[model samples]
Target: MFAGDQNGLQGDPRLKAISEAIRVVPHFPKPGIMFQDITTLLLDHKAFKDAVDIFVDRYRDMDISVVAGVEARGFMFGPSIALAIGAKFVPLRKPRKLPGEVISEAYVLEYGTDCLEMHVGAVQPGERALVIDDLVATGGTLCAAIRLLERVGAQVVECACVVGLREVKGQHRLNGKPLYILVEPRQLTNCSAPSVTIITRRDQLSYYSQDSEN
Candidate 1:
């Protein structure tokens, strides 16, 4: 069983709002997987707003020059944080998704190898960037994003995610870059297939399956 570590964001009402908004789906895309679905969270206006507000409050004072968001879900939070922090938002896309000259970085996933790309000139050298994603599992995608930014000479300030699977130890792959997350996974039982308790940013509580190995 995994112990709970709330990252000290516990007890904040905003954490409760965000926690309540998420929908957990079990055995999604595969068996023994519990997917933390943010689409449900997006439906709640107040909860979504609170999620953005939490990120904005953190980055507003940091002189961030770019917000590099991973393909889809990161799109939800990256633009808001970029706008709030007076920075530009850049999308790190999947293979061949963008037009014009591009740069690519390949990384390992839980299943296989994949690549991420960005427009060649989207970010200038020496810019400070923050990488955003919906969650961090094995950290493969975020590592690719960081490499993409560094290839352009952009300094990665940090990586942010809404949720993290503690067992995966994705944070270790960050090359010492800081990772900020709203929730962390805690195992609820001693069974081989355990359910998980999620400790929200404000230490608000919720539960989901631990089936997903990512």
Candidate 2:
């Protein structure tokens, strides 16, 4: 069991199962990028179930009323957790994808800005929400999703992901909201293979900023 300053995950066998199931593709969509592919993980039923079970076990007791999944991948884990925890599943979609009075939030990416949209009446004031995503790279997408939920008065309980890239430093932009993740950043090496590391709490978000000042 890995421990950190915050709430820790104990004796979780699902972590290893998930890590082994991911397939890493080299230079996908660009050069010098290792893409962590979950589709391969999805193909393995036991691995996929283990991944969802880890999240469901953690959030099942929490009073999360809505599970908001980001555009594509989040749709996979969000619905399962939502159903397990007895919450409604809401889709945080891409631009112009949702119809009928949608609310949108724009966030900065390493290259530029992109927008995420949600239906206007999807969340009500004071409702509790949990944001789900496959991975946290630069955090722009998740940040945008959080803003969209908060803009309409929903309280975002936390952001959850299967993997987090510490080198990318997107966790810094989460605005102090707790991010629960199964795999830590250090475990993912530069090699062209998918991997997973032990879980840990992200206590600070200004790691990149502090490095840049030096």
The candidate scoring highest on lDDT is 1
Model 2 C-alpha lDDT per residue in residues 1-214, reported as the tens digit of each score: 2222233655566676777787766544444335567788899999899878878888888899999998788998999999999999999987899879998898764446677899889899999999999877667678888888999999999999887766566678897788887764332455643332211212112122212431
The lowest-lDDT stretch of 10 consecutive residues in candidate 1 is: 198-207
Tell me, what's the RMSD of every candidate? 5.9, 5.6
Candidate 1, overall lDDT?
Answer: 0.75
Q: For candidate 1, give the lDDT of residue 119.
A: 96
Instruction: Give the Cα-based TM-score of candidate 1 against the true structure.
Output: 0.84
Best by TM-score: 1
lDDT per residue for candidate 1 within 38-80, as digits (tens), equals 8898999998998888888888888899999998889989999
The weakest ten consecutive residues by lDDT in model 2 span: 198-207
lDDT of each: 0.75, 0.73
Structure candidate 1, residue pairs in collision: 9-201, 10-202, 10-203, 11-202, 32-211, 33-211, 33-212, 34-212
- Kindly report which residue pairs in candidate 2 clash with one another: none
